[model samples]
Target: MMTQNLLVELLVEELPPKSLKQLGDSFARLLAASLEMQGLMSKDAPVTAFATPRRLAVHIGNVAAQAADKAVTQKLMPVKVGLDAQGQATPPLLKKLASLGADASVVPQLKRALDGKTETLFWDSIATGISLTDGVQKALQEAITQLPIPKVMTYQLADGWQSVNFVRPVHALAALHGADIVSVNILGLQAGRETQGHRFAAKINPIVLHNADSYAQQLSTEGAVIAGFAERRAEITRQLTSAAAQEQLTLIDDDALLDEVTALVEHPNVLVGTFGAAFLQVPQECLILTMKANQKYFPLLDAQGKLANKFLLVSNIRPIDSAQVIAGNERVVRSRLADAKFFFDQDRKKTLASRVPELNRVVYHNKLGTLGERSKRVLTIAKAIGLELGGEALANQADQAANLAKADLLTEMVGEFPELQGIMGNYYARHDGFSEPIAQAIEDHYKPRFAGDALPRNPVGVCVALADKLETLVGLFGIQQMPTGDKDPFALRRHALGVIRILIEKELRLSLDMLLKQAKDAFAAQLIKENDFIFDLKIFIFDRLDSISREQGYRPQEIEAVLSFLPPYLIQVPRRLEAVRAFSDLPEAASLAAAYKRIHNILEKDMKKGPMPGVGSVRNLFIDIHFLMEPAEILLFNALNTIKPQADEAFEAGQYTQSLQLLAALKEPVDAFFDSVMVYTDDANLRANRLNLLTLLRDAMNRVADLSKLAVN
Candidate 1:
């Protein structure tokens, strides 16, 4: 047994750093799928893939020394069917072609049939193996054609090429198996055993990859690049902290800024830089924004505990004149911060409350309405949430916060930084002499910004977030802008997820339907032209809640089954989910599943088509002691009767699986009843009583889930 490795690299002039990660992942998946099809990747081998902005690298470990030669079944019709029994090939199929659509060819044929009947026949093809070189070449060609790239171009001799076209100019292609270069053509570039490295940090000369094994370090040295974003980020962080320690200052790691910075550079060079000490007079946001947004640098607070006027930068270049690069970046940031300070001083001249009406001057959405109009709707909804929480102070605070939430949108600072929409509102509100909670709630309104982001920390802020999300969902859904699969343009999915996280994480007990109705009522005046019915209105929002339920780990069927006759209790679904998970751990569960499976099978087979037999309310004969003729029958009846009301009581107390377990305890008696007695006895009343008991068993089983849908394993 021999092991082999394969490595590929595309040495291009400065590939976009932002697009590399996704492109690298796609290239790996495409190569793996194609190689497996060609039998180059063995069942025992594992494939590894890594990337830098300038290059994509792959290594296949324990790969077969040579690809297993290719083979596949090729079906060919027999002469009788091929020729339509006229010794002439069938016209339609004969016109058809191979998998890649080449002209069809005839080969060996045979025929077989069942029990003396006429059988259609085919050429049962057992394809003979082809050379290993040919197999790997075909896979390479297929994989290269399918690799996803945002921008591709082709610059080689274009006209005569019979291969796939691409977006980028093909300069050079490298591919190696162990130490040998694989022979193939990608676009116009030939595959060979060489790769390129860091555009600035490494040798000006390209690295010759003797084999796939030597790919990683060679390219990193050449490009001065890091293989993973996470690694690169961590290195920058450590260096920045060390540099900050020199002056007794610290780097504030802004995650949002880091993500953008990560996408912008490959090989990061960290350096400390300072702006004029006088520019420190600017508000902290101004200095931080100018440094973070414009220069892609991290800001620091000085030892005296003021805006330090010092910053840390990550550059793609390693400068011999580090001081000159630092001075050039600092000069650019100072100009921007000066403008921000001017805007801040000018904007604060007008009170946040007075700026409310100016929001009408800005368009929220051309079709939706003005920003001021949206603010009014948000305030209305927030008051309802405040009332639900039983905080009279919070309810009033929410209304004040909602009215001022978009006040910053009218400010120049927010206009320059769209992400600072609610942010500036909080700052300005505080200056306008609003209370601290109201001022803080202004910024907190945009909490749970993304999946991993924080939720609103204050009660007042939670109220505003609830109001803001409801307005968007209700307004957009009213106009039929609801998100379909993978197309949540309005981010209704995030908003719904925010709602669930708030309720669950905060441990808030509230009815989902009641909250949905509040959203529906917010749009009641707007829905007049659409319809008079409540059904059409609530379904859109309820549909969102159902989607939320599934993501919260409840099955849609379970949510719907429970919702059928019950109130819309968001809190109960999780409890029910917990109970279902707990029920699976019981020793009696398997026995219950088996018993239900047996009796359900009998009813399913015999009771549907002809006559439905059931045990009804007639207990008189069974009431007589002699009618309890069989001791086993008496015991089974007592057990089921005892558990029936117990299941109902458990359900009433919201102990769903406890209820199922109560019913599950009847499993033994159920098995015995079916084992000992015949249901269709000559005595009609006895038979009816037995059937009614079985009906009770079936009804109880329906409470937790449709038991048949569950597989025991």
Candidate 2:
């Protein structure tokens, strides 16, 4: 029952900043998980992971010096094969016992049990626990092997001949159980208490950790390093905010940039720097990108969210005066900003319209044609969409935008920074004196490039956005390059979700199937007839929609009921799902859903058997009103006639909840009919009449959704 806290550290050269956080987290989790699995640590042990530029370490609480011994029962062969006919040990039994480190004297101690009809022999033994030294060594090796390292480096140890592969050249390894150093070795380094701190700011050159729990504190005081990833990140954030507030500006909020900066330095000192005001003439995005991407500096923003001339730099060392650091950062960033300004000025000389011809040389895909041909197809789809959404005005604007959406790919700025493709197009479009909506549409075509991203602001933008996404999806699927598992090289799934999000959020009255068909037809000249994958493409989009619905917190049954029909109007799906959820709360909801399921099963079975004498096919799903024989059946028919029109009226008026609730009155009559009437009567006329009545029941119940898919219990 005795336990102690444990510590492990791997000191090395500076790691890849982008992957440092992941490497540290994975190392700690994998080590702790292995120890817990082997019963060396308890389930609730506290684990703290630390990652600096030069080290990865973990402190685990309440780890046992040795795993407790466990009692295990082993099942052996059947009794007949293990023992002779005289109930004495046979040669096979003796050999089996010997292999288990047991002898013939202990054979009588084995127990007999039934395993599938034959009696089997079982042996019970105590498994000895593993010592802390052996356990920590095994865990340390596993943690190193399982790090999420982006790349590895091969380097020679001090011995000068033997080489080891790791994320960086390992300098030292430390392992401690309580205050005692545990014997362990990894990456050609033996375990010890010595670890290096910050490259320059540390008070001590080689900091020695005396105890497991003192790792973080000692590193901060003696080594001048904030070891915990989250802790270091918080400290950087606090410093940035304080520094920004003093300048009456705000730092751009980017978590990824913060994490990378935290991983790059041990002790953060936020220093304010400024660039030349002449760069303000360039687009704010261009200046901001050059500052952040080219130089690892945080751009400051004014009250209106415009990029300010000031930027913040996170320095690893704190000096008496930060003037040198600030000035050096400003000098480096001034060059980057000037280059951006030059690209912007040079790109504006040639408008987006004049760049259209250059798109022909740009290959979009090997199978799909160049950007010019692709833009033409998008123009065709966009025009049709715009005309459907609005009349002539929007159509012209969408066509203009679609023609120039990708023209900026030829621009010098876009060629240098591919992320600014659509953005540069918008600016160029405006410089050419195009209308505001058309200019905006050029940039907004890629509006929902990511999840939860905004959709196009205007109808023209929506038309072009929809067309662009559809073209990509259909073109890629046409060539049988559909995504499988986690390999979506072309990001078809993101495109599909973008399309779905726009249609649903913008309330665009567009048919998903119609858009898919338009996309397919746009590629008609390129698509071979046998390779058309339109149906599969639609399924893929619906799959994305299903995921979105689940994330919106709808019940599985509610989503299943609404999506089962695969309604043509995806924008109205959320309303229908909400209605289904409300209906499920009604007292009559369960009975009605059960009866609907029964009716569906009955009709499905009838169709599968064969077409009836009068019934032609599944499409001819109509009920004859002449065969209402029983009182229960007549009541149900009358109820359906009364409620169907009312529900239809509400549904057409967009009162989805009211339309679904109108069917609750049918539950009583439906239950009565099922109890008193026989749907599969021997008489042909009676059976046909009952089938038609059930069909009528089904049609009335499914006005808003397929109610049968609702959960009854």
Candidate 3:
């Protein structure tokens, strides 16, 4: 097998750094999928993806010289319903197959084993043999042209132009599979062996790629672009670290700023620049962000444990005067630091205590009324939740912090930087003479907005966190604005996940049913219409809970069955799942499942509807000696009575699975009862006795899980 290496490059203007990476990934995966689906064989290699401010590239190795030849299959019908009245091969079908380059053949038919019923079928097949070159070309075009480039624009306004447009004009399309050019006519552009070098440095014409590896080598020397992000990043980090070492300082390790810097340059050249000691008076965080965010430079701290009056910058080109690039970066960073210093100074003039009353004017959400209104609601909701959870300190702290949680939203520092929402609130709360715990809660309550974020750290913070999330969920449900499919505008999923973590991690003792209704009532007055839809709140809350629990090791179906009988759906789904798991371990558990499955299948197959009667409220089982006749029936009667008491004790002690196992011991008797004693017999007394037994069994089974509804899978 010849190793056919391939390279595809799309040369364009600078792309949005984030979107370009996603596009580069999609290009690699979609191309691979297209080839695999076409029955092409390629030794799977790590797809190397690269993106510059200007171009995106992908290289694949060990690609097959050609896709495997395809053998087509099609079902052909007989020309006559019963192979013609002459009982011979039909001439019409034979003619069609001959025209299609296929030899007509009789396919076999056999008698059904269930009964001696016979049938016959024939196939007159056709295949349009595709040349390897044509197939590869067609596949490549589909992969490139249909690549997901959202929010595309039109360019040149010319005929045969591409429907998809990117941030910059796609000036060149370079593609090569081995020594051959993978030619494609896309929109108005033509793909060939020719590619151009960097726009600024060494602009050359039509560099012909020899092969994938050689193509990458030629691009590095001539094309002037690094072909891999990892390689480029490595080079940048090495250069910056070594350069900083010479100055006796350590470079700040900011992965995020490193990524952004890497996207900005095709060729990175590390330069260390120095600033005046006068500017070092600025706070460390402010100076660091200013250097990275404003100037795209990595700041260095001196070994003396002081802010070094210096920063490291990665540039695309060596300046004619090296001193100019260094000086220019310093000036830009100084200006950004000045703005931060001004904001910091102004924020301190009025203590956070003075601004507390002004928070009433800020709007939290247009529909949820004002921030003041939200604060009041949070205060009430948190107090109630804290009390229910038996945390007096948490409830008191929540009441204090809820009043000042959003006070920072109105601050100049937070307004300019939205990411500082909770930080500023905490700072201001401390200035307002609040206790340390209360002040901390203001910051901790907004935690875990994203999957990677941290949770609130203290008991008080936890209550406030719940109050904040509950208000959002209950408020949205009230207004009939809910997340479905992929649409989660309010991030209700994150809110629910926060609540789940609090319950499991902190082990709170509050009931979900009571809390959910309290939240619903807290925001009930704000709802304009759909006043009657309050009953649907359980479904919405449970939907989020189901998703959260599954991630915590609870089976989704088990969660569903447990929630079916338990209202408010707030308890640990994993606990219910555990109960069901234990119940499944019983010897008779399988028989119980099988028996219930049989009962459910019969009812469903007959399309039975409406709730069937169960042994209503009879906690104890009766012998009914007059009705008992068969030995199995008499034995089952005694076995069920013995198991019921033991199972009940286990179930109440949270040994639900063990209870199920104990209940499952009756499978043989259960099977025998169904096999010998008829449930709906003509004997009215016998029927009543059997009905009572069934009711007892159903209730026992329901205690663990609704076994009848369990899917065997």
Candidate 4:
């Protein structure tokens, strides 16, 4: 069958801007997958997705007009059931054949084969291929059904009697193969070649697509619309850059903002607008956020990376005289900036300390008590961490910062923009004459709000950040509201990862178990019902750490070897993993790892068999060189005596790599012992001595990491 490019489009009311890209991509992928599964298109066929505020579309190349016929072999009932003992077709077999559009006349053509232990009857037939009309209809319906729509709207169709649910009200449907209409109907609209374009700027009221391949070109030329989401986004980026260049400023690079703006307009015209200089006095984050979030404008920054007075707005209509558009945008932005300024000025009237009492009214979580209580807990944790990290002076600063961190929740600025909670607290802290370190800590406590985000700037900030995350994690876990699957409404995974990042990246010597204990201690005993949650919480944190380590390029075995030891301080994990990786590369590494694994197995088997005669208990076993009868055991014992101290000294000095490297000298002795010596000998003293020696060797070799974990079976 010959193939031609195919196009499908759904024109509707404005779609949710944030979801348009996903919706378009999913529609194309699902539709193409369905077609390919139906044999109507190759899996490698090229697919293009187009999405705008008013449309979602896809164009797939090399799609067939009809799927190829398939030869199918379907299993029937067992021969004993299908054929009577006399070899005549039974009533059940006749009924089964009838269901498959066959009858007794065709029963003789059935084949018998062994299925498991029973001889089963099979029917061979050719399944007819689906026509383009049926295939396209099914694929389109499947695409729409599987679309990742954020929400669905129920609306009446043109007939007013029938209703349909969609992301938005569908006004038109367009689909074509080459130059011919595909004749598929959806949402009470038949597929056609016409689709509406830009609401106000289209040269034609209804854009007439010429063919499957001409959809994008015609839409761009006549419809005054950039149909492809990425193409439109790129065009807007280019324009923003050019506009920003003319003013000698740089555009704030926010991909999310760009995508939202792209979806808002089919015909993007980037125009620069100026705000009053008075507005620049407000924090740039506040003003920039208002412009990007409230008005979908791009804020420009000066050479020093400070927000400038001028910003760029993407207008849907491109007017010949652009002064009015710029002025209209500027007027709207000035009003927004004025509101921000008023909030900022009003929020500054009260110190963060004064606003602290109001947080008592705001609930953090019903089970976790009010934000005020949470703040008190965080302060306790922060103070403890600070003392551990930097003594009394830093503890004072962290305590003060944590006390006032959530105060901004009551501020006018934060009330209007929750994203400004920590930010406004910082401003208020400084305004209240607090020290710079304290003010910075208030803001930086929420540092690393996302992946790859920067950590808190100073020691005070680190203490508070760690405290705040720990409080949230321990409190929620205490209340039995722990995150399940992907439903982390409180962002516990992020909090755990935040803790992991701070501990590992900041090289904090704080113990993970100690921190969890500190957090749990801050909460009242009666309020925390999960008595054993610390163990579960520790496991959760380690799981997140394992994921982070893997993402950072550590191999699974290397990670397991280090993490299996459950090193008290997370700060030691990276170095330990590094040591394990380095140790694995040594020539003796394989033999040593294998021998360590063998030693482990021998010790485990002996321990399971209960205490030996000479060894009172495996746990209390000690090496006795006097019991070393075999030369191999004696030689290994000598090797251990010599190397153990050196490795121990290096490990104590935190020279993990060097320590693991020192163990490389044991490979030959270990191999010889395993080959020539029997750990479980007939002589009880020899067996006890061997097991004790292996236990000592295992302990010494695993100070940095479990070497047996690296062993390959």
Against the true structure, whose lDDT is highest?
4
Give residue 191's error in model 3 in angstroms.
4.0
Ranking by TM-score: 4, 2, 3, 1
lDDT of 3: 0.69
Tens digits of per-residue lDDT for model 1, 467-513: 89878876776676767778988887788777767776776776666
**Alpha-carbon lDDT, every model:** 0.69, 0.89, 0.69, 0.91
Using TM-score as the yardstick, the better of models 2 and 3 is 2
Give one digit per residue, the lDDT tens place, for model 2 in 104-219. Answer: 89888899999999999999888889889999888988888888888878999899999998999989998989999998898788899988888888999799889888889999
Show the lowest summed lDDT stretch of 10 residues, model 1: 617-626
Off by over 4 Å in 4: 78-95, 117-119, 615-622
Pairs that clash in candidate 2: none
Sort order, lDDT high to low: 4, 2, 3, 1
Question: Any runs in candidate 1 off by more than 4 Å, and if so which?
Answer: 1-4, 43-50, 61-73, 81-141, 151-170, 176-183, 191-196, 204-212, 217-267, 276-290, 299-309, 361-368, 524-567, 589-713
lDDT of 4 by residue, 65-117 (tens): 99999999999899999999889999999999999998898788999999999
Any residue pairs clashing in model 3, and if so which?
A: 160-187, 582-657, 583-657, 586-661, 588-664, 589-664
| TM-scores for every candidate against the unseen true structure | 0.75, 0.96, 0.77, 0.97
